[model samples]
Target: MIQNGFMTLWKSSIAFFSLLLLGNLTGFAQQSIDVDSLEQVYLQGNFAPADSLELLDLLSVTFQDPQKVIYYSETLIQVAQRQDSTQRLFQGYLQKGNGYARLGNQVDALNNYFEAANYSDESGSDSALGSVYVTIADTYSMNKNNDNARDYYHQGIALLRETDDSLSLSTGLSNAGDFYYGLGQLDSALIYFEEAGPIFEALEFRIGIGYYLGSLGMVYGAQDKPEQALEKLNECLEILEAEGDYYGVAAFLPFISDIYEKQGKYRLAVQYSERSLDIATTYGLKEQIRDANLQLSELYEQLGDPGKSLKYFRQYATYKDSLSNIGLVQQMARLRTNFEVNQKQSEVNLLEKEAEISELRQKRQDAALYVALGIVILAFMLAYGLFRRYKYIQRTRDVIEKEKARSDDLLKNILPEETADELKEYGRVQAKKFESVSVMFADFVGFTHYSEKMSPEDLVKTVDYYFSCFDQAAENHGVEKIKTMGDCYMCAAGLPFPEKDHAIQMVRLACDIIDIVSGDGYSEVTGFEIRIGIHSGPVVAGVVGTKKFAYDIWGDTVNIASRMESGSQAGRINISESTYLLIKDHFECEFRGMVQVKNKGMMKMYFVKRTLQGAEEVLLNKTTETGE
Candidate 1:
């Protein structure tokens, strides 16, 4: 069976953007390149600016050795920097990233890509930005972060779409197809490659056209259309071989072999696999070598050639172990540590030599030495005082910054931004009497008994879950949440800033609050319901305490709201007469008659049935498909 073997590695390093960057350059990149000849020419250093960049671009894309690619890319970067060529600089960094990506050094690869991104951004060329993003998408794709890969691909393609750069846009499209191809979405993969096909053909970009054909071939192979698959694969293989892309040739040979193997043509599969292995081995393409060996081993086993299977399996294992970058990582770590140790030793030796020179000078002239020593002492004391002052200033600024951040966080989290700003300016919040304000209270029905059945952790989680929903409902309807006391949630509107439709807003919020607990899964979730209440009247609102500040209201409105909640039935919204009168036009309410409250005597209350058709709608996360 076909697998995601070195397809990821192949796409990550030698994908369309690799050549896309080269082809877009205004030099010899559009022509066929003899990379060995170019390398020979580069070895005989110091050419004209244009010629050097052109040669480097061609060699960067054609080089089979990743280490050599990196070395040349560094030289390219220096040349670009000296010439102040943004385009060439971008290509240099991108080539370095591609080399690292090929070597499985993702950290360094991403670092170089981001460095290229900075240049791309500064260049303000959408095509440049798109190319880098596509490169980044390849790296992320190879890493199997599918979500980030898709996002980056979309960003790259979108940006490329806005530019007149057909070549770069085609690169983004085909690579995106490769992304979906790896994900096994054959149809999606085909669509992208097809979309990119005409662009490549129009530009006469042979490499791009080959990749497009190859991608389509793979999709057809996966779909079991062997005739079409073989035709496309063979056509693309010819193009790659002609272009001297040995890496692509080695990578695509296995795809052709997979198609033959799936068709039960064992001999043809073996021939193709061997061909891939030979080329991969010749070019030192480690990933392709391992993949080809494994493919042959599996094919041999299927053909009943146990001896060949065992031999190829051993070879595969050997390459797999040898190809791991772990030892390389450790070697780098060792080099870094040794460099640091040597640096410290050099510093120590320099200090010792300075001390010896000072001693000799002191022995030569005692009076002159004393005078110099006194000057040094005075300078040292002055430096010490200045250093202390600097330290003190820095410490004070740090403390102020930290305290300011903490205070800002506390203020914004606990209170509203406007309220926080007012408190900051005045150092105290004055109680303001709002003529009309709507207050709401929602309590979980039978929560006390529910808590008894659940563990302490589960109990808190349950309460928090329901209360959080209530808070969201309140916030969505322009209701300001005051606080939550255990299972009860309190909020108000028209107080922090007066809203004319506070009563209507609160009623809609109450309906949403009921909706949260009225779901079909509600009984299974908590085995309980919620009771909501609303009232409207004058209320004095302000921050109450100095240490533990609370923005609370003190009036009959708050009391009535609490009484309404207490008098409410399970899964119902109870409203005081004052609230009903204000919201009657907006909501349907059932008269519940005058109910006697504990301390406040009898009060007229009504149950809010549902909101009117033209009224404000509830916006809770628990809102259903039916719009209930």
Candidate 2:
């Protein structure tokens, strides 16, 4: 897979080489020419030098034939030389360079670009000079001389800043982005591409958007973000397809295919690769054809179709050989050797100029150096102070975060998790009514009497020990422990977060609490018993209070549950009629005759002994197990 991915990248790079030249043809649609009329005027030998120059520029770009471009450019150069028109000469040389570059003749292309630079320098046309510098940088980039490429790119941008040429500036930024992208400097590439995106959009340049977004998509894909890549690439593909730019569409298809393949969408990968192949074949795009074949070959292999994989691999090999015969590597090598030679000569010239300046400024150099040293020392002191301040602030932030976490944990301990979250987010919580919930109340049988006999600390510790045990039991059975009164414990099931098995869970929790208090060790240590009552009905639960927040429930259900607990005897579990209906099939119960309550009228109650074995055995064993 790694080898296949590298091959795909190489093919994409080759395909994009042609696109690099098309930047200059942005307004070609507006430059349409009547070839026959232009040729007739050129043959008549009566046109002005400016008219001749315009004709040649249009012919060079519009023909789509490299030999014709070369012919028109050479003829234009001859006419400009005869007429001593430096601007026309610069244009002719630049156009010739473009033609040679398109034909994969980088040696001649660089020579013509340098010739154009000489004429542009002599004429002092900053715009023309910037354009020549951009072409030279692109050629160096193609040759992989990154240092030279970057140097010339900066020089071109510096010159372009003095001219009002937004289109050229946009193209230069995009080209610089592509150079960095090819070198795998994705962050730097993204900076340039994003800078160009707004310029292209303002100009309503669809072609520029297509290329800019495509570069962004490829960069995102290299970063292993397939979704973002698809978003950019799909937008680019839509624009290219609408404009009937089939070659541009073909160039982007392989990138989409690679993203889909990485996402494990094999069918979409194959579909895109095949579409790329069809478009490339129709348009005779050799680089795209080779890329599509390679992608399809690997995709088929992943899909476990060896026969189709082999077929596409064979086609890929044939096109790969054809691409090699185009002499791209040889051209790049020659271009690199020439660039190195020119760069060394230019460095020598710069050193000579620097020596002359050094001799002229020797007297002032010492005073300037002393002033620079003092400023540097002062700046360093300020920077050090800022750095220390930053460290102190970071430490303070860390301490604040730690304390915040501790407080949040404390708050969660006092309230239910969901209620605590809501209170923190909204500053208050609205009460919500639950149609049905299980409310359980547990009270120590002789808590008040035992407290009066023992020391205050001893009494508080003993109560804490038993309530802690109850807390654990409630948590284990998924019951919410609401709050505890002085001698009574209060809790419920199914508020804050709803649970369908609230009644069942509450029953289990009550049983666990009974077992904990009646244990041999527990009874001997504290000499206390617990009474638990559970009743199921509608209740409204919420956090109440602006300062000291408390989560509590209210309704007739709470009243009945309290009555059930108060009416119960020692060491036994009592439940109201509402809760017994919910868990009748699960536990054995004894129906206590109707009991009168203060607020609530007569209510049916039951004493829960132990869980039943089965529903049929409820009738067979009507006996209730008495507490120890």
Whole-structure CA lDDT of model 1: 0.79
253-296: candidate 2 lDDT, tens digit per residue: 77888887877888998998899899989877676777788788
Candidate 2 residue pairs in backbone clash: none
Candidate 2 lDDT (Cα, 0 to 1):
0.78
> How does each model score on TM-score?
0.49, 0.47
lDDT of 1 by residue, 1-628 (tens): 5455534544544443343333333322434556677788888875775788777866776675689778888988998898898988988898888788778777798789889988999999888888788878877777778898899889989999999989889878888998888888888988899999999999998877888888888888879899999999899999978976676688778778888888889899889989989998898888778778878878888888877886777677667667675565454444434445697875666677679979987787897788899999999999999999999999999999999999899887688677888999999987789999999888888877877778897776767777777777777777888988888889998868897878978887877777777765333354578888888999998898899997888799999899899999988889999998987765677998889997989989998776444333433422442365
- Single out the weakest 10-residue window by summed lDDT for candidate 1: 19-28
Question: When superposed on Cα atoms, how far off is each prediction in RMSD?
Answer: 23.9, 24.6
